[model samples]
Target: MKIASKLYRTGAFLAILLSSAGFTSCEKSLEEEAKTFINPDDFFTNETQCIQAVNGVYQTLYSIYSSPDYWRMVDLGTDVAYSIDVNSAVQNYEFGSGSNGTGSLWLNAYSGIKNANLVISRVAVAEIDNTIKQRILSEAKFLRALYYFNLSNTFGGVPLWTQEIDINAVSSLSRSSLADVRAQIIQDLTEAEMGLPLSYPSSDIGRVTKGAAQALLAKVYLFGKDWKNAKATALKVVNSGSYSLMTNYDQLFDVNTGFKNNKESIFEVQYLREPTSNTNTRTHSQISYYIPQRDAGKRTYAGVDFGNLVVDGWSVFLPTAKLVSMFEPGDKRKDIVLGFGFRDQKFTRFPKPGYPWFGSKFWDLNANGQSSGKNLYLLRYADVLLMLSEAENELGNTAESIRWMNMIRVRAGLPELAASTTRAEITNKIFNERAIEFVGEFQRRFDLNRWGKLIEAAKSVAVDNPVGAAKVKPFHQYYPIAQEEIIKNPNLEQNEGY
Candidate 1:
């Protein structure tokens, strides 16, 4: 163990060719590609070099989101989501170890963890100014926590690799308990909170900040049923005066460049696409996943013009009929969040007879061919408000819960819940509100899982999505580990029911 565990024999992290995410005018955006074959000890000598390594860590996000099954796993198979062209086994809750969806998520998450590990391990000893080194390490730790958060949620408990692992000895490592994983996540985030800055300059706007760490930690606590801490952390973000809901829900998702990292966004995965620039190849076709396809070619489409959106769509995802009906009568978020009818001011043909929906929030007005530069929102202030409501409700603070829930409700033009409502009813209200609010933002499955209603939520939509609902099973809340990983390391045990 000791012999092979010496400094990176594979030099995997040192071989990284870093590329920057395009977020308006980011300092990292101008980074030139690094040559391969650099010595690991020779790296991390300066601020610029440390940033370049961390930028590589951010690049893994593009890999994760660019996975073909990313959306299907996150949002496309639950009660709120229905699949037509999405062929991922998730539609039927029939995942296997070989599932591309599972493998992609696992691989990208671990890849990100590896990148973050390199930054954390090396930058800590980089001999730079203590302040600069700590901030850079903080950014890396925040990212590491996020990737592990995604892993533990999806896989239950995975092999927890905190420090840089030796490539030669990696196969011998085994899974850690879920509790251990959670402890490490909490530890990483706690350190991140103290090290991260309150805000960043324009060139570094999308980088993780103090609020992002706090917001994510709040969610982690909320999901773990640590209501007291969750409530406190959520309230901190709310009063931090750093974020607020956009006056119009439509403003949150539209193609306006001004809204990419708006005040409502606490943390968002930044993406950019130029009509002609394929230099980075980070531009993706997530915009094409749900926008209705063209008139002449694709199998599904809407009857009326959707504001001249020019993109080919797979039309794989749609809101379940049940989800569409769940919206309250005056809720303003419905139209912006779901695509069901004519986008023109006058409602045209309903997409009912054949098609029921196309995800409207993902529509990119400037889509070129099949690609668009829409950023994925991971955390928003609206989510913070709702998390607070859930935490408060759990603690029997129904008044405070309803007050926060009403903030979201009133923003969507729906009447507030009655103060006399029961705590159980408040729970349901928060669940439904979050379901409808985050339609295309990739969070429903996690929410359903955390609430212990994944199977129930699937069964609820049986009438509308019978084929999908029929396959729902309790074990699907956590996907099975990839078979390939187990084959490579016999020490790895498969999750139950796979």
Candidate 2:
């Protein structure tokens, strides 16, 4: 009944949004039927409709990444983050096909992939401007690659779908090998780079760009252990002259500063609460989940009450003691990353040891005290620098790696590394730097797994928390394919140790 395009909903294409108000337009474009849906024959008649179609792909990211279960899947069971909730706490080390988060992530990714595939397969021949058509197709390709990248990283090898599939007609589907998936992801991103623009106007700010494609490609290479390409691609973004570290580290995550598409961000999912819609939805619950629980009556932290810092929160996602101590001396990032303790980075300290240390990077108070319109960064300039540092070190370019590492170090108020640093030493330093830099961004588990250090890292700190110990296992490296998906497609097999 309603057409919800991802780009159209972010206030980028208000014209398209208004046109979707009528049923005829909705029926002609992206309509989902019970068994067989309408083909793209009538949908790709114009550029506006094509844009509306692509927006549906973007909408899938919100349900995937913004869910509470998604964060729990990545951070809760790791050394840096702990979950107070029982179900979430169990995910730190153990996850199965039944995991709600796994199902949501898989379903959301494929849903996005389906939409992306539709756009890529049909929008090119539309009677739209050649440039606009290519850009739309490029964005669709980038998004499809993103879904596959996440799939491969999480499930090792997932069923690769490049073209739209008819659910009723396709009775069975098989998973692709991880190698094939990685190759396809790389191919998609490389092809996407050509059509993507270097930048966009303020209204079109959230659209994928050349830098975003490169950044994602670099990450894919990093995950695949392609050090040469990883360093090269990451360096491309660093030297592109399009991005820079925010002068103030704290402002990088501050929602109030109007820093949504700042120079540091390569790509981010844009969310809006105003101009709100019911069927075509917009909003996220991250703020309410991340806000620390505190009492206004008792001065527990910073000689102040917790309610003073946030309206209220789920009180989950507490930081581990190991994470608190990992920060280097004189590092400003430590204070910026954690809250509910002797906090000096962005807020007052908690003098009393009453409240758990919660992630403060996404701390934005909303009017309803629930969802906040804070945009989450999928790729940032800081991450590019760190990736380059890691990639160069892996390539045996120790001096070159330190050069990049020092850039992030200097920004966090830490001393620069010596050029004589060893590969082992620089790798550890880079790992620690990323942990501090990207806290509360849900990056730790992936980094550890990619580096082959997840099991060991979990083992080393398992003694600290029995709950964490219960969750950590070698089989936990990749999550199982959701049971629902397996049932829908018998070709789907569960991951090992599930």
Model number with the top lDDT? 1
Tens digits of lDDT, candidate 1, 50-159: 77777667766667766657777887668887776535577777678887356588877887887788789888988788877878888889888888888988888888
Model 2 accuracy (lDDT, Cα): 0.73
Over the stretch 119-230, how does candidate 2's per-residue lDDT look in tens digits?
7877877888999898889988998998888778788988876765564433377888999999999999998998999998665778889999999999999988999999
Worst 10 residues of 2 by lDDT: 14-23
Q: List TM-scores for all candidates, in order.
A: 0.90, 0.87
On a 0 to 1 TM-score scale, where does candidate 1 land against the true structure?
Answer: 0.90
In candidate 1 the C-alpha lDDT for residue 94 amounts to 68
Against the reference, the lDDT scores of all candidates come to: 0.76, 0.73
Lowest-sum lDDT 10-residue window in model 1: 1-10
